[model samples]
Target: MNRVITVRELIEVGGFDETAVLAGETFLEKELLGVTSFDSPDGHKWLRPGEFVLTTGFPFLTHKESSESGLIKLIDDLVEVGTPGLAIKLGRYIESLPPKVITHALNRQMPILSFPMEKAWSDVIVPVVRYINDKQRMELVQTHAIYERFHRHLTSGDPVSNLIPLLHDVLQSPISIHVPTLKWNWETPPAMRKDETIVYVDKQIGQHAPRWMLNQPLARMTNGLFVRWLLHDQKVQGAILLRQPDRDLYAWEKVAIEQSAALLSLEMERQRTVSETYQRFRNDFLQLLVSGKYGSRHMLIRKAEEVGWELAEHYIAVVISVKPHSSPDVETWKENLTLLETIRRILSMCDLPILFGLDQHNRILLLMPATENDESAAKGILTDLMTTLALQWQHPVYLGIGRLHHSWEGIVQSYHEAQISFRSATHAIGLANAPLLHMKDFNELGLERILFADKPGAEAHALAEEYLGKIAQYDKEKNGQLLYTLQIFLQVNGNYVEAANLLFVHKNTIKYRLQLIRDLTGLHPENGQDQLMLRIAMTVHSFGYQA
Candidate 1:
């Protein structure tokens, strides 16, 4: 709690006769000026005007050579050097301030004050200094307390449930800490309305929020305040918004909240990292199950249960299939994952806990607790989620949901069922036309083995050889020009000028070769579906098609 001593407080404490001297009404120790002990001018070069300088006017101003003109000139020089105000000792100086000096100070509004002849300058300055030092010390203590609370909550391994209570205790208010990152369909806060007293600390996010809770007068004026603090250390990690009662929060309180938020942000990141590691292991475990390595799945379930998930709970498997309109590379997939993580985080806000695992088949499986307690509401929530994701990513995704099962033993069965439904949804009439698919049809499970098959190495090799054989024949017949053009075009994703530059040919030459390839293979690179097939074919030819 930094004490802001007003000019009035200074006058009262210093025993200055207000009638004899005038002080600027706006002078503040923390804002307009800061007080520092001036023992020597040796190391205080950065001191400038607008800052009140403290001194006894002792050694230099005492000599006869330092006449009234010299004294006035010294004040003038200090002011000229950006010293907005000055504090002087009265007893050591000539009995009283000269009329000329007072008049000069009054005209410039440069505040000058005299301490009581008996009161030492050090005594007057000490209280203000002490106040500031004590404030800083208290802030340090509060910061430590915040970290302790945060560490306890995070290490206890329950974040969302513990966060509100921990923050409420620290802020001394009923805090609602809303993480937009964790709510998939959550709307962004809108611009603040008039008569709003909420403060926003915004982090850099690519998208804007569409709604603001502080926009309501009741929410805004109920002594309720909003604060946004950026998570400085993490890339793509969103901000923390603290909404507390509008009781005056001084510098120390603000510092404490900000520090606590920073700690929470770091802990959230750590938890995310641990979750990702667990998901990766889960993914590997599930893949082993699919590959008939049942022992690995059993081991992984044991390890996961140790980490807090109740393996015996009824769970449902959901498989998310993302078929890029055009074939996407690894970098594209990584960028998409950032957005997917945001969506997953949002879904976690619901009472149901979700665990995400990515399989070798490029499917995202979410293991959610199976209770039809609010199945309709959950579906509505999921529909909004799909819509939001489609709008955000500008691509379509298909979802397959499997029936609920009793335990971890049934996960593989549900997963296979979900995969079948995923394929059936992608192929059925009117179903394939829809942007989102809920696997309500259980009969789709019959095609599970055929839909998701693990091809032998020989069969995969044969397919690759057949595709490349055609491409090689086309290239040889055209003197290797077609293959060369295809390489450059695909590298640039069929951008003419870029491909031309890479091939050291005119854009027209590259375009002509692309047209020639289309004529030879009956595959138009301009069509997204054809382009995707060609891209996959090119990749398989270049790198053997084994996961």
Candidate 2:
């Protein structure tokens, strides 16, 4: 808080008590920070904002032009420089302010006051400067006290949430804290939840958190909202918002908000450090579970309970990864952690016995309690959750669930199955249009499950070449899609019209391609044996491209 005096207050002082307003009376509330007496023609250029200028109108009197337009131009320069007001001694160098000058000043809302010619400039300068210094000293003392109060809370190890009430009391108004990157928010009464204006602002903050966090503190927004950014390690981590319904916030209130923001930043950093440490330990425990390293069932259960994980008789493994084409930026370790935490936060609402961590491949791994009756509900929850995550991340997400199994050994088997299903999920995306959530279950993989289980070897390569290699080579040489047509034909169960529709070609074109495939591969799409061989070969051949 600067604690500067306003023109309205300045006029109540001893030397200014006899002064009269010549124009722009309504803007007397403009703050006056300093006093200056200058007669240089260009001295206004050097004047700082909030300074009150005292002139005898001599700059205009001795200048080349010394006309009404010249005085009006001087007023314009002063107004442009953001001077609080002008105090001009009258009936000395100039008879009176020109009517045009008064009108211009009035139009610009620049305060113009007439000083009494009898009083010397020293009378106003000396006392006004002393008064400003005294107010500044008071401001420093008050701000220091506010800092001490906030520091006490910080040293006491209080969380960021506990500081909101203190800030609200200081501002004497409703307030909100929003940390969109972490999906965190808090508000005092007259909840921001119901305010559509503030909600829209929050949405904006969510979409542009990385960029908006660096914005200046105390930035004004719609509906009398003042935002002070919470910065940590030079990054904007969150924001503290103050709402003034009936009036603007005072300078001192803003000072308190700033101090509170610093405390919030420190507390949030502390929370993040604690969270990361817990995640590291949890990750180690997950690695142990998936690796089957625990000594016995009883020991595993005890270890799980320590991390708030409830061991269930039956569990299913789920793996989540980002779609390849979803983003161009390399997924850094920090981003992966953010994605993992996001999944945990969303899944915690399901009230199921669930354990979350990163797999050996650095993808999100989940061990969700599975019961025969609740499997469908769990899948539904995952589908909806993945869809929500996709929207939140602004990209498609891949999800894979393994078959449910019993006991510790089953957890390891299900985890391996999940890794296989995770691969299938990525391939499934290429088989159709990309949905926001691409999900696959190991049990539902059908014939592809066998192909995924079989490692690529001499036998697999020979089978692929014996079945569809010629057709693939022909399509490549002729710039054709015969191999693709056969696959689509098998996919639609030999419906020529359906295959043609999926391929976006004429039905006749589909028949022509199938004929070419048969001619080139000596296999037919309508024959059950031939179709099985062709599908298996195509599935195996696709594996050659998987990472």
Candidate 3:
């Protein structure tokens, strides 16, 4: 909304002629606050520098009152104050410009122009003001057009498919949208890529991109202005970023982008709510089936129908268990949720219907349709699933399978088999290379023997009494060195050199400790039975014998 006017424009419009004269000759085209007339004897003191000063040099320099020398001295003082130009009213003040003032003005290059006293200064100011006002109106119209296009797309109910195109059209630039997959890491996108298109919704936005699209020459140009929004309803499992090149977005464009992002985020949250509700229904249905609450075909069929299932097809069940090997504290419910989601995604890729349940025990049960394709493909699929889970989660996982059954009425049979396989895979003492089992291959009574042979509290109590007695004796004798030595020896498997290096002591010092252990406990670590007992005692002491 800024307007700069030139001196030539001002002169032509003001209708001034070239009769009035003085010496100095430069034109000052800067903005002026007000215009007024002044006399030379006032000595340019009332006026500041760099302003357009109007005068006729009349009253003070008239021939009867003042001499030419006094007038010339006044003009000299005015130039010293930085007056770059002067406009004079001629024929009313002096007959002509003083000779000395004219000479000095020419030498200083300060322009002096004359105007007929008949014209007013109003002729100069009005036109420039009107031009600036018109320019501002045009800028506002352009801003509103861009804002309207972005707002319309945001409210259209399909922001991912609609908003990017509207923005690209308005800005005249190509745009890309990416959504990330919850099952995989950020480097992979959940959905397929759509390029140079106007319509599409990605199932996974940021899963993967072409190498050319991500590397330099492209990413550097596009990613700098990318905007990201987290879909809060999805538990922060995914995000979306919008990218464009060539055009720099203005402040109004930034506002539009954020508003559209917020709308998309809300929609994603609504979808997640629906997904979670469906999952809860599936969990309740499976729990009822496994617990034998719905025993008859009629009862199971009615329940499945209520939950929106077709209810007449055969069902195959698979159970997956994630074991915590390092520490119980390391287990997380969110991680289990992610694992269930991944299994569901993989199963869906095969176009199968799967109902899954996850429990606090870190176990998942997937009840899928028992079509020929699924039954024939189950073994390879489950093996690949186990390997994928191990690689992705960086932990070992065990899976168990059950036989195919026809209809919801036979789900209990499959459930029993899956439970037995889960038990056998997890608890069988020395079984190696055991495939995921079917109901007939496993025996309920045999699993009972393996599962309940040792009560949890009995082993804990025995280890506690043995390890606690040694700790008490060591504490009373004021000899913590023996406990420290025993811990290090067991840690190194009785290697004298490694244990000594760990303790930063001579190798003989560790040998002396082993001798001292025999003196104290009357057990030699060189004996296999004694070594096993001591190792168990040390492990029990470290975890707290009380627990």
Candidate 4:
């Protein structure tokens, strides 16, 4: 770090040795960055932050109320411009400053120092400017050294996590690198920020000037915490946060932090590229694995092993079919991409080897290791996985789990079974009426296997129309919800109260709808045979409607 000269330090310099601290003694520690001697009446207007000002006090001599408010106002202006201190030759400026001026300067913490009349302004300005210039030169050298060190780390293939200690060494402060979407962290915090705030930060991302260093903080959190955004392609990909440092960071330290952020951004881009390539290969491998096209099963297993998949004695296949939200505002592709990424991150933490990839149909596919013939354990794992995934998504995302299968061909069967389970459920009941997240397992499918395993042909469609056509026509003509009510009633298994509660209506309404359904289809609501037939017709009708 380059040494900063403070107002107190200026007193020790050769030209400033005879200066007396007249007021604002508490702010003698203010950093002095530049010095200027201006006698113009409007000279205070041109003053900058951290500059030390000097004069014969001649500017105040012409003030109408030079001994009072006019002097106080001048002091206020100097303080507002953030001048480190004002050094005045008091004897030459119409005797002395008013008491109010000193009181105001002291209150504002604007240092007021005095020098003898013989002290030339050049004696002060030349040495201060030289000192500042020398410090800046040293800072440039230090900044370059830090940059080279980071460059060496980047070329040496060190991971971003390893670079944290190097930054800690330079800053002597707690530092963290956070990529929240990726759930990657080098240190403790992921940073506390609202979603909209993050979006705003992203909008402001660009190549900022060096003056932004230390002067502008990306985030204004408390406890001296600040951040530098990690940008990739002009987008904020992540951030590097510095917390509770001994003091504010200097320009060179900020430069080092920025360089580290650049390195991290580069690493993220490289990882993303590598992940994309790996995903393509993984997708292709999964397609081939489930297609049963490979000649040698052992070779296929070896290939899976190479990709870090442990082909257990038994494994269950899971298929997740993403149903796009009904809202036009939702982007289906972006939603699915976020869902898949969330799944990948959560599943990566599992103890058992779980392989994930997209099937040929573009549905998410997972082959999770399981014990031989233990369907319950696999279901438990799938349940936990689905529950975790559900918490991350706002809308319902459906999943189908196949029975555990052993051989390569069995893997294919398991994959198909998984796909069929979810498709069957969707055909039976629409996505809107589904739970927050839907998980259907093949082993759990009973009559649904017979009801939805095959697509209903024209004959099956006709049977459904024969039973439901009258009610459907009634709904279309009258804008009635009898069909919807009947569907809900059947779903609740003739529990009038439950059905009514689901529809937000009275039980009598459900009974009335049931009677109307019976009158239309000539089927009794309480009769088992009639109920079964109605259900089959409804399922078939749903399948046809969706198709």
Candidate 5:
């Protein structure tokens, strides 16, 4: 409704014709931009579209050779140029109207009215102009009112779902917002975006920031269209899907959708900012807790409580590291925000107090309440999370789980165990012909659970490092195969031929390397006690751990 005054309203306000005598009456609802008056014969030549012309019949009276026909041509010309209507002050220069002009104006739906000879342009022009300007002002007020309502809803922390009903009220059309990226909180789009819409949207998303039609029904929905991209600076956050079931949208409807998208963009940006801030806070807190920096359980509990975390006495830790598939459009190294929400949504049903964070290496660290009896429940939750993430996103994700621990400091212990288990699983999965010790194989991870687990007197067991440390230093200095030869030799239980087969070398070469290993250290290969010590050192070295 925020537009120029219509021709019908203009006539009523001006009282331009007492009997309402109109040559063309079909298009009274046509909008008029302004009013102009002229007495020249060629006045239509200088007229602008939407200008309602007022004239005394001088043009027709002066040109006597082509009076009726020329007037009819002028009437047709005005209609073609979108002049809504014309007002002729008759009875002075011309006696009565020409029938041809009236017939031509009527055909084109151009309203042509005749006023009295005594009336000046001022009598009608001022009143009509005042009415148009007043309507224009009123339209501005309505537009501001609409904008303010949307602004209040956006700033009031209402969810994006709440805006759908608001748009319904504004547009008077059934509308839905389809954002595939953030579907966790929103309803699924009326029609699932098929391969057609998906491919098109994917190709253009974050590229075009505008309202557009998909040119057809997206999927199940029929007869409604237009997708407005929700963008902040070139990045597409989501989209708004407008539905007008019976017909295409009007100009004002399009305007309302665009304005609503603006408010939606703000909501998306604010949420992004808040999510980032919260994730960062959680990240710092998790790091501090796992770093063992706090002096006591009381210190940790107080800090955890500050963030509304109810830290249970017994807790289990989980760590995940994900690497997204390579895409030319994305940065492969950055931690994906999608991973955060995916984890949140997947585990939301577990009925446990969950606290989680993301680490610098694109790792996720989560602590969940656990007890002796919750083993099956914990595994079920983990299995659900792992399966959902893998199936939904199809990324290379590694999950490391730790055994339940009873104390606050045990939380740090659980974290280290989980990280070590993760790295160990990764290393094992990479070995040629080795059975994979995957995170999902919790039942078979008995040895892995103790591989890097905390135990008393780690320094005492570190004595094995003295043996391998010399061999490691020699290999570093000479790039020799002595360290590897010693490890293989012990692994094969001092068998020259078996070690040679495993190393893909001649038995003589293996013997030769064993002699060199003997020269480097006094522990000869054939001695049982010395071989046992060397095997211990090899095992510790292979773990990539000194203690």
Candidate 6:
């Protein structure tokens, strides 16, 4: 199963009359792929990793002053570039190797090989090239056989599950394929799991998934072949795993895995399209049911059954939203899909009887049977999900969970609560306290929900103006920043240090402004009541004002 050709094999192919390893004899086992001649100092560029170089020692030997130094530098360059070994055709341009050069090569463990005096550069390069080509030809035949074996199954339009057997055949090992996102049962999509196959993640990459147990079969597992389903922008859709636990992988085996991955990508891409369509239908269906548009209870049950939901008589509704911002439309879509898939996998792995779907509003809707600690369970799910997502998205994505509903039909009310909670969180952006809410914990908004329930009326605006009209007028007249400073100070709970940060000013500047506010408004912020009054006035002014 060894695919790597070694230096000794190539020397045997060259049929050198006499050969000796001057240094690094142990390192002669280095794997070599091809060979080329190096007559100049910069000829290293033509050589690649795992290649042997044939040289006349021209550039090094021609320099009599520092021939040893030149050879030393050449050896360093060869080792740095990953050239396996060097074969010098002796008694040509170079008379003999310097003792220091031999020691240097030994220290570096770089194989310094010598060719018979009769062998020219052509003799070495030709045989090595032919040897590499012969190996490649044999590899091609083996790789072809593997490809054809899988190509037949691919051509037959077999389900992705068929890949397991084909890979088992190619590698002569047991194989398993795990698609983390593939879940649920739907007749139209044959690939969809009938048992709702769960993909578990306590934060592990695809390669790290646990191996299934097979008794007394495997000694060691090989690295998997990951056929990544990537979008045009290089966003991965998912991966198909191929593993053989019985033996170490050869280069040809890896190549075959790559081929199977390609086939799997095409197959999965087609399934993705079909799945997306079905998901859209599911989304529309859930939106209708949750929006309370069902004509009868039977109709609701029927539609729910169509999407494979085993709904309980009583249900609790939850909504998860991704706060939107400026991102490319395509990028946003992909992220949402990826997030939904992950959530689905996690829920399925937990074996929770949850019916979930994505709506057009960038929200995930869920219906679960009401339980004793359903709220606590929901909180735990969001806690782990948000932590995982913060790492997954590499950006701060927020979510809001509505209060549990008494009945499934109460989704409309619960969803609205989630929206309000989400609003309360997002509205606090740029403030000292960020909006990171989950699972009915939107208590952070306390009374602002009522105070700023609607856009400020004329009366509220007039009241705000009366409280700080002098400061506003002064700002307008002199283009001063008293009002701006006041707003930041109030938002930071009258903390001068925090207010200074918002204004990008020193604490002295904030103090001077606070004194000015006291002199101008006659409302001393030093008083806790006055601070509260000022905060209320500011909230009234900014009511329904969005950035």
Provide the clash count, candidate 3. Answer: 20
Residue-wise C-alpha lDDT for candidate 2, range 1-547, written one tens digit per residue: 3538888777876357544888888888788788888877888988998889988887787553347876788888988898878888888777777788888999988988888888888888888888888877876787777778787877888777777787877677888887755555778874566466555554443233455456665677766677776665454456777777644555667778878777666667777888778777788888898888889888988888777677777778898877432233456445666677667655643444678887666777888776753567666666676665675566656777887766667788788777767777777753243365677897665445446553545434555775577777786788888777877888889998899899999999988888887787667778876677677777777888221
Instruction: Provide the TM-score for each candidate, comma-separated.
Output: 0.44, 0.71, 0.43, 0.65, 0.48, 0.61
Prediction-by-prediction clash tally: 15, 0, 20, 0, 0, 0
Strongest candidate by TM-score: 2
Candidate 6 lDDT, 28-112, residue by residue in tens: 6678777777688899977788878888787886544438888999999999999888878677777678899999999988887
Which portions of model 3 show Cα errors greater than 4 Å? 1-161, 173-243, 246-249, 295-302, 305-308, 324-332, 345-351, 359-362, 372-374, 427-547
Task: Judging by lDDT against the true structure, name the best candidate.
Answer: 2
What does the lDDT read for residue 10 in candidate 3? 41
Give the higher-TM-score candidate: 2 or 4: 2
Residue 372 deviation, candidate 5, in Å?
Answer: 3.1
Overall local distance difference test of candidate 1: 0.55
Candidate 3 residues 6-113, lDDT tens each? 334445545665534444434434333233456656748877665456666665554544446765665566577765466766666655667676776666656666
Pick the winner on lDDT between candidates 3 and 5.
5
lDDT of each: 0.55, 0.73, 0.55, 0.71, 0.65, 0.64
Relative to the unseen true structure, what is the C-alpha lDDT of residue 529 in candidate 2, on a scale of 0 to 100?
Answer: 66
Q: For candidate 4, lDDT tens digit of each residue in 313-397?
A: 6667887756721222336545555567667766654544677877765667888777776778777877787766665556767
Q: Candidate 3's error at 421, in angstroms?
A: 3.0
lDDT at 416, model 2: 70
- RMSD to the true structure for each prediction, in A, is 16.5, 10.7, 19.1, 11.6, 12.9, 15.6
TM-score of 3: 0.43
Name the weakest run of 10 consecutive residues (lDDT summed) in model 3: 181-190
